[model samples]
Target: MSDASAVTVAVLDDLRQESEELDLLVAGADAARWAGPTPAEGWTVAHQIAHLHWTDRVALIAVTEPDAFAAEVEKALAHPGTFVDEAAGELVALLPPGELLTRWREGRDRLRAALGAAPPGVKFPWYGPPMSVASMATARLMETWAHGQDVADALGVTRTPTARLRHVARIGVRARGYAYLVRGMQAPEEEFRVELDTPDGGTVAFGPEDAPQRVTGPLLDFCLLVTQRAHRDDLAVRAVGPDADRWLDIAQAFAGPAGPGRAPKRGAAGRGDAE
Candidate 1:
């Protein structure tokens, strides 16, 4: 492989690490735990894994069969608001615990292989827009990390925050306007700066240095905020201006309709460490 391919493959390595982390979380769980409820309302641990597996399968089709992927997109468009949830429920109910785990692992392997072989500059069609190879990998990593957080929460396990969160943070910073756009509001013209303190005591900065609007916080909290896994009120994230504050309220790093963010956890959850 070329040096460029090597670099891209290294970026994809994060996906493998994330998958392994999740595997370790679920690998030894008994059936009762697998069927237990997660932070996502009405979704059990099995449902989370099933959704990941199904999305991975659909993403593979997008990479390998463009026409078939377009047809699926059309089906999604036909039923606007409820498609994603309905689809997840249907797929989750179809599998036993062992089958679900096997399907998820198989789909993840196939997705990694297909993405590794895709041409460097080709864009894959997706629900919102096309994504370049690197963007796709980053998106996949973000999904794995976000969903994994839910599983970890349900299992009462604490996950170590890592530098890999930079990718998700970057996506969050970039999606500031997307958050507004999806909600049918025009994104503000002024750029907003984002500065995050990394787990290793380093910093990752985005946007203009001189912008009047800014957000500053721990990187893990920023990731959770953007993923809608934590309420804005629960995070240490500070916004300097009105627009920045609005973005924090509705920030979404992932594609799709505006997510109904997690309801504020009633007690200590509102004040606890985000990661």
Candidate 2:
């Protein structure tokens, strides 16, 4: 297969796998469990699923209706800071757990179909810059895994880390500059190396081999840090050099605001945050 085709296949596989794992996790939960609080402050399991569904719809619009998607982006920009959060809350409040799950599943299926049909090398507009179909698919996978973590934590369930995290880790490393740019800081000129130990007893490395700045850690810890799912103090990632240190503090693989990530849970025990 060509490189682009390979990327599309890998991203789709990861997306489907992540969704299936999350589906099994919430399959038997009652309504009360869906209403349980997640690590994201004030966001319940229902909210997590709603957010994913809403984004899936937005992505579908991006791929299929460029003008409409542009208009929606303009609307979001007009309201500025509060629109996304407000819209997400409204969505979750309107849907019951079963309905929310159905909506998410349907939207994701549509999104996958749309992505598959997209012409090769075509770019889809997003809340940020436009992304190629492969990058768009990978972004969806990253979001799915991150939100799934929230749902898993809300239910106090342990998730088996998978090799799919390699995609998230790669995104995290590539977004090094974007993270600094969003914070209005000048991204460092020096190249930084990221070394991660994956769950399958393999290592994934990014950036130049002899770069001065480096981040080294378990894949789970690196993924958690970049996704803003856990506090830096709660993760085991180690950074060398000033740029690497600052990047770890503000690492964001996803677009939008620098989130007020989860607070360090000093005494919380047996949770997945630290691992």
Candidate 3:
């Protein structure tokens, strides 16, 4: 296989692993547990899985049928805010916990298969922009991990950080410009240097060594920030330049309008302000 093909396969594998990990967390959940609230306001544990299932089905359509995917995009455009929540809420209301879990598993399996079989160099439609197979896989992995964090938190379980977080961190770094653009601000012309300490103690650096703007912190913390899973005040991530600092306030890895990030935990040291 070519290098690009190999990388795509690797990302697909990671996406599968990430999904399975979250699956294990919810596979045996009871109704009460499924109804448990997560960090995302008004989103239950079941809602998290339901949202993933709905998105996976949508993504499958995007990969398999572009014409149909256009319709899905139109629905999103028609009700950008309520569309996602409505889908998940409907799923939770219609399906029992076990059935919801089963459907989510099945849908994700189909999505993985569709993505794996897609032709090379073909970009698929998405809520924001078109994405290659690899980009789609990485985005899936990122969402899986982010939502998985919610499930883990609701269950009062602390998951061990894994190298899979590299995918999430990479997206966070690449979405720097999108973060600004979504907030109606222009992205800085000069790239910012980002150095994140990986889970295993090594560092993964992005951008140039001599870049004027810099962000440095734990890879997991950065991922949490971009995904809006944790309040920035609870994280150790620090930015050096003015733009870099502002970027942290509004950073988001996912598409759509800017998210209402989690508020700082009570009594937590405030890390300035975030939007």
Instruction: Give me the candidate number with maximum TM-score.
Output: 3
Error at 148, model 3, angstroms: 0.6
- lDDT score of model 1? 0.86
Per-model C-alpha lDDT, please?
0.86, 0.85, 0.90
Winner by lDDT between candidate 3 and candidate 2: 3
Shift in Å, residue 217, candidate 2: 0.6
Task: Give Cα distance to truth, residue 244, candidate 1, Å.
Answer: 0.9
The list of candidate 1 runs beyond 4 A from truth reads 1-7, 266-275
- Alpha-carbon shift of residue 230 in model 3 (angstroms): 0.7
Best by lDDT: 3
Q: Output candidate 1 Cα RMSD.
A: 3.0
lDDT of 3 by residue, 132-186 (tens): 9999999999999999999999999899998889889888888888888778889
lDDT of 3 at 62: 93
> Model 1: how far is 159 from its true place, Å?
0.3
State, as a TM-score between 0 and 1, how close model 2 is to the true structure.
0.94
**After superposition, candidate 3 runs with Cα above 4 Å error:** 266-275
